[model samples]
Target: MNGPGPWGPAVDAQGAQDVLVHQALMYGSRHEYLLTAVPYLRAGRRAGDAVVVLVEPPVAAALRGQLGRETAAEIEFLDAAQWSRGPMHALASCHDRARADWWPRGRLRLLAEPVWRGRTPLETREWKRHDALLNVVFAGTPTMIMCAYDTAVLPGHVLDAAARTHPELAGPDGPAAAARYTAPAEFCAECDAGPLPPPPAVAARRSFATGGLPGLRSFLFTEAARLGLPEDRTLPFVLAVNEVATGIIRDGGGRGSLRVWAEAGELICDVADPVRVLADRFLGYEPPGAKGHDAAMWAVRRLCHIVETRSGPQGTQVRMRVRIG
Candidate 1:
């Protein structure tokens, strides 16, 4: 197999160093997409690395048509829409796929396009955090990841944020170092600094303990329905809020507060506790298997449109949101 080529450094003479080639692909047209992604995939195949692509359905179809079914079959493909269900779920799945297919000493070549046009502001924020946390999550791993962003569809803010998250830029010409890249720690701190807008004036407030979980669930359902949350979304939203409340009772000092409100066509729930249960600054963004005991937060993330957490000397607060009809 050929050694590293255009995208990253060559394998060391002594042994392969754990390297991560994180790049952003800003493509303006279909031809640009083919030009930037195809060569990278070809290089990985030439180097005998496992290649995986996670992208939207349309892009996947286009890639398959361009690469041909037989050739595309050589690389793994996952739906970016599905992967975005939860940031942690997506990260966990990536690691799991890597371990299942290539672990220990195997090298990986992956392309991911997790954010797309029309993403809610809350989703945009969380996914950006997910992108920044990748550096820490995959530190010292022998992997090359290319995260694609469509310049024609995504807004400037999204593109600018993408530039900050990735350390390299891949184009038709080849890869180049990213000038705007911000280290993960600083990027995360910047994101965490801006908490979600305060929950709309609380329509209802309730205090609960472990024994009061059922009552909290019932309260959330009624308030959600009263606040005009879509019937279909109410249950999932309730479940998401329930998980956060449960986390508070189980880990956040045995008692907590829940506040429900409506804000600009969205249902918001704020849960706070006395104990600071989450120690990791990037807890919800990290994969569950890596941190353990994160299933509740993972579920909340998947079910809710937004999940925001803030911890300080006072305590920890979790705010979850879902669109209301």
Candidate 2:
């Protein structure tokens, strides 16, 4: 059932047992989502209930380590792409079996945005849909899907309050609370009212370097736009990378320098000035986007996961250590 009400799934936990499924796109960096899931996992352990975690491939190793042998053994980890690319019928059968065995597949929930079209400049209404679609597909049994990212922002105390206070479509004391949230009457009905207030801004301050010679050239161009290094100054560096390279010249205000060189297989970079990275610890900074931005922040975060977790094939390593002066 689709609704415009506060977006999220409902689990009835009045008297029976439960399993809370948390599908994470991020490895585990979102603190609020972890904040929400930790309590549920702990509560399940304390009460001898079940809790399962479904994570993407890059994060499985780290998660296995964090949860330890016993607890980790209880939580199941699977690849996120499996749900999207795998055979649907076989997946459904497997999910059903797991549910029968009291294990539910976790869903990666996306905060739903409204569809807009028609005008040259479209008008979009605000609609917030919080349903764990991914979790439901993977999880065969009755499930409670919660987003790790949102839960990170919301402390456990706050969610416990909402769970206790909000009118339960089905009371936690009831049988439906543990079931998937796809049932009728479990979703918001007033989407016409518009979306929830925009979520608080997340900080996303970081540089994107291509690595090696290509990386160096990209950095120099980026720097030139912001710092305006002299053409005479950049000419030699440009030629080193550019074959038919003429000197780089600037007509207006720019104040940055980019240098490129080779070191083994990895690219090393040093930026004199950066595009104002956020200083806050909890949130990364996001820059405003122009039309047809080559990549999305989602892609960047995925790349970040690769850089942070794996050393990669050929054992090449990329580092982004910040050296504060």
Candidate 3:
């Protein structure tokens, strides 16, 4: 079935629409943006219909802050804890039970049939393929189908048969299904470079530090090559690397300025307090936990430089601005 056209009841169901957002199977780090789900809840309440967000514990906490006690009365938050007990149990126990009841029985019957089948990988894949297309049509909005990192090998026939033929469906990554619900067009156009213009002195300081040291230059070149970042993108990467190294110097048991440089748009680093951050590559250093107050701010400043430097249609460097904040 064709997805609902742009102006359809599902998308226009302001104040009276019953919408179910299925966020199951979403990992925390990758899907942290789901934290924005609370804003959707707030939107639903304002619109006058009930909004249900089904998510795991970590997501629940992040969302609760958005809803808070004051705004939460109208919206419902369902925890996905023990959702793995089984699919049927998950569907029945999800916070949206009442809303699901309002859906037509035939629709419910069709939806429930596949709940069992989703347990198997093959079935889940087929279901997602089916749902990706159907959600757009039925709901008159975009739906994101979470695919594995290795989606390059997906058969052309599979995508051809499932996707809608629309120019608006294009995403930063190409043919984005998630763009349906969230307006990808706006996201693509809006460039909010956070903070202000960075001092030239800071830029010069970084340039000098990187130029004098081969290790720092090599680091930038290596990482730039690794991510295929363009020559221009090196500055941002350098900034990002320095920001990280600086965080280490400030937080770790170090007592010197963190030094950085860029070569061919790759970052190299030398910390005055080296012992803390110069751990064995990859396996040695622990993964950075949730970035804290100062760390987050530093990330924002660095990412803003990246975005400002490379802002344009069809920009090579994917905008990393949002995560910085």
Best candidate (score: TM-score): 1
TM-score of each: 0.80, 0.29, 0.29
lDDT tens string, model 3, 1-325? 2224221223324533333222212222424343333333454455444344445655556666666777765444545444433322332233134335523221110111122222443223333333332332223212221221112434444343223222233222222233334232222222222322333332222222322444555655565555556666556655655554444445544333333334333233333333342211111111123422233332433343222222223221112221111
**Model 3, which residues run further than 4 Å from truth?**
1-35, 81-120, 126-325
Which one wins by lDDT: 1 or 3?
1
Show where candidate 2 strays beyond 4 Å.
1-14, 17-29, 86-95, 103-142, 149-325
The lDDT for every candidate, in the order shown, is 0.78, 0.31, 0.34
Question: Over the stretch 224-251, how does candidate 2's per-residue lDDT look in tens digits?
Answer: 3344444553443333322211111121
Q: Judging by lDDT against the true structure, name the best candidate.
A: 1
